[model samples]
Target: MLKREDSAVSKPEIQKVGKYDVKEELGHGAMAVVYRGYDPFINREVAIKITDTDRGNDKDSAAHRRRLFFNEARIAAMLDHPNIIHVHDAGIEGSYCYLVMEYVKGAKTLKEFNKKNEILPVEKVIEIIFKCCKALDYAHSMGVVHRDIKPSNIMMTSDMDVKIGDFSIAQIISAEVTQIGGIIGSPKYMSPEQVKEEEITSQTDLFSLGSVMYELLAHVVPFDSENVSSLVFKIVNETPLPVSHYNKDIPEELEQIVQKAMAKDPRNRYPRGLDFAADLSKVYRNLKRPVVDIKEQAKFEQMKKLNFFRGFFDSELTEVIRAGAWEQYGVGEHIITEGDIDDSFYVIISGDVLVKKGDKAIVALKPGDCFGEMGYLAKTQRTADIVSLTPVSLIKVSGTLIEKMTVHCQLRFNRIFLRTLIARLSKTSEELAKYRPL
Candidate 1:
């Protein structure tokens, strides 16, 4: 009763597949048809991916498609990450082979967001890709390499959580390719190494993720050509126009991350998934502007008064103020919590603040004095807590915005940053001299 009356969708639709009762067709692709199915044993719904090699294809092509189906089952079994689709069952009944996975109701592929009108907001894109990086990290930890990381393979549930599927071309890192053979991944998403038909590593997945990010933000693939040969050559030899070229509003830091992930040489890419995720986290935290209400002119006036910003022209200072977050904090509030991951350079506009490590107060800072210099320069976690000694107002500048400033403005900040570092080092030297004997 579960078998089809005819291999074609003609001759009265057949019903079940093994023990599961097929409901309705969800969607279909070249080699598979997905169905909304019910598993009576578990009383739960599932998505059944049934291999569909039509009567026209040769045996070789059909065999390859079947291998991909079973290979996905094997790969999915090794992965239990939240961001990956969970495979429930895989079976061969009569002439049919099918794989079942957790059904995400109203699930949609990221390909839906690739259009210009459908592009996601910048922060939302960052969050989605950040989750993807975490998933890849977990899979790579298990020695699995997802050879194909394309937009269509990434699913977004109704609730907005991401799930990466289609591990059909994925391979075990240390094993020989026995089932799914050849360079069989979407050309637009392939890395340089993949285009060259060379062995690849986890970094290839990162490259593919970068390609996906490019398309999501810019609404165009990084590399596209008229034919496969031209595309492969471009993947290996050409550089895409900067993402900012397409969407001027994309953050500079995000564009840099995209370039690095898609670097031609694998060695130049993020060494680990953790490393890639870390940078994305940084971008998410600092690049997003805080919602606030402050007159731009008033903020610019406050910034120009600071001795640190004396060299900036009125226009340059205006640009800096517009880029930074101007906010006020209550007395005794933590301005920068110790061990918090942030790279915001702050300048006290009014009131005083104190720097501390544990129970010890390191120093006191006043209006016109800037803090977070080392943290901003080093791009790491805060080493000490900066607490408002009194009700305070300050401007917090993120590194992402700084890159977009004028050359003169950037150079001035750099010079003042160096001067601050030198002054601190000098004070430390003076204190050390007290311990020295003549």
Candidate 2:
């Protein structure tokens, strides 16, 4: 016989919920216990969220929790997006109710990365938040306001994919509030309007997302306090320290994006999620370094290990990585031709290059060496014909892009280029001296 338990048991243990077998506990929150459930009928794994109505301090509070549980199911069912968690089914059996949702194995909350003492790579942070913006945009277009947009509610899969979940507190843009003067959501990430118990809109989500992004980049909540009242007060009246203040590595443009999104006045914040996403896109594109995707990131990492980029700041290195393309050439391939009018500089990442004066090979340049800079600097034709001595990997930087670098970055590059040129000249002079018979 199957045993049934509802409300409370001396030992709180659950084995089944509806048609799903609850295998193990995934996580527990103030109002629900999530389990890794197996759907026998569908032959698939799912996440079953069981409502804990006992979260309320009083009978009315318990009733409110129950209502919100069903509300979340309804709201989640209304959204369908790759970056938004999908709801499979919701049902109530006896005195228990559960929602079977997409079980993203190995998924962890963004809260893990939103700490005051640590942060992920800036490129990674930007990528994650950009996805969040797109997801929020879709939800807003469907007339839903995700009232509870916080770091913990955002999940990150093992492959770094993002999924926004837990829309239980969400409200329809046109619906009237069932709970008068009610303030719902994580206080720390709430916007000024939410703190003041004013009408909420899509801009509110933008503000919350900004707060989440701020924490990820700076490692601290925009507003922090020991008590709820003080926290709420600060949220409505305070301005957070610029993100760059905490992480000097953060660029001024990125900090400005965060500040604009977290503006105290909702009217001043981004009008739509699309607008917010656009701003993020602009910053990501304009960054001195590329954090665009995994492939680009791998290339950037390769540049960091090379000796030529040793003096470049991490930020400047990113600029260098984005300013050029990493390319490969086969042996006998011409890299530069004598008398060719071009100003592109090249750095040997691997393999070798042969520098030839007309028909004779003058030098064999190895990895970490550079070529064509003399012509590039002089804005003239190449003085030597350069060819790949073996299969080669190289970075070809455009003079046009290099000109756009920050003054400091450009100055550092020039210093290194000068040193390299001087060394090469000295080597050539010594070799020529030996040819001059006594």
Candidate 3:
């Protein structure tokens, strides 16, 4: 969870691991100690989590700890996201196994702001949690579920960027690994299903995130009792006091988000992190804090006006709206980064963008122009960067979700996408033919 220790129990009595030099103990828990280390090759500081070799002679405990330790390395390293901690490397050096992770220079645990006197402004909470939802959505799309998603597992940078850390107990759900069941999670933030050791999914993390959000807003956990058993009972069988009950200043729309997130039934909770983020984005607007005033219906209308959706029916457009996000960015903002592995097709619904490779402008895109054609068809990396040339509004659609649309809708959409790609190729050929010395 990237949790730091108040005091060191003992040092590892070592100077280095591979090319990294151990500086000091950053924190220590029951199983491992996080040390501040320096990577000589890259010339940067990193957090080294070294698992204890001698927890006990108990093989099961040691095995479980080792598995969990490596699990974080294997899973977190694969997740290349800004909001998720990046795992650089992992290896075994004699008896000690360790992970090299990004050292977030100056950040505070979400725990610090959950106190009654330390609550952040409502707008900031919406911004912070919105990023978390997007991050978790990305993780869920990749088949990783952070089983423990409490406040301590989430970090906020000095600039207010959110990072979800400590995937040590995260489970990889896939076709082969159908379900996971274990009474394994932080009790205070555990969902009803978690306490019961029911099959875990992305919803479980959403429920935990709800508890964190509740604590942040109301200055109290949704369900709490000094008595452990009573707390578990409350989480499983009771409805939490409405968030507005504790903090009347909290908006009803925001409270509903917390309520839906913490719903006792997984089915009642947000179907996906994308849905969670969409609602929060709406609440952000209701608070009158949106950068642009595009509501859902307005966004739908914008899409309808786009030549990209000319032949699609309103019902089909509604499905498209549900399957995508309407986002806004200021001028000079980088809409797409070169070399990033993303599969989101973007349509400029308003304003313009400059598509550049490095510093050279390859082309300029206007409203109704589309990009990510290849990405829409596969999990490919971007070759050019798309930067906003003006205040920009975009509809970002993930390839994964687009596949779930109706067959007729897909056919129409693909036909148009193919046309756009072919037209671009033809234009390039004509330009190249002019340079040929026949």
lDDT of 3 at 143: 89
TM-score of 1: 0.67
By lDDT, the candidates rank as: 1, 3, 2
User: Which residue pairs collide in model 2, if any?
Assistant: 72-168, 116-219, 288-319, 289-318
For TM-score, candidate 1 versus 3, the one ahead is 3
**Per-candidate RMSD, Å:** 12.8, 15.8, 6.6
Q: In model 1, which regions exceed 4 Å deviation?
A: 5-14, 53-57, 176-179, 289-438
Q: How well does model 3 score by local distance difference test?
A: 0.82
Whole-model lDDT, model 1: 0.84
Candidate with top lDDT is 1
Model 1: per-residue lDDT, tens digit, 1-438? 555545454222437888899998887777777889999999999999887544344787767777887788889889998889999999976546789999999988999988666779998899899889889988998988898999999999997889999898898887766746578889999999888889889999999999999999889999999999999999999999999999999888899999999999999999877677767866786665444578887887777777877777888888777667777888998888887755569989999999999999999999999999777688677899999989999988866567557888888888999999999999999999999999
TM-score of each: 0.67, 0.64, 0.70
Clash pairs (backbone) in predicted model 1:
none
Best by TM-score: 3
lDDT of 2 by residue, 78-107 (tens): 899989999999987644567899999999
Q: Name the better of 1 and 2 by TM-score.
A: 1
TM-score of 3: 0.70
lDDT of 2: 0.81
Error of 2 at 96 (Å): 1.4
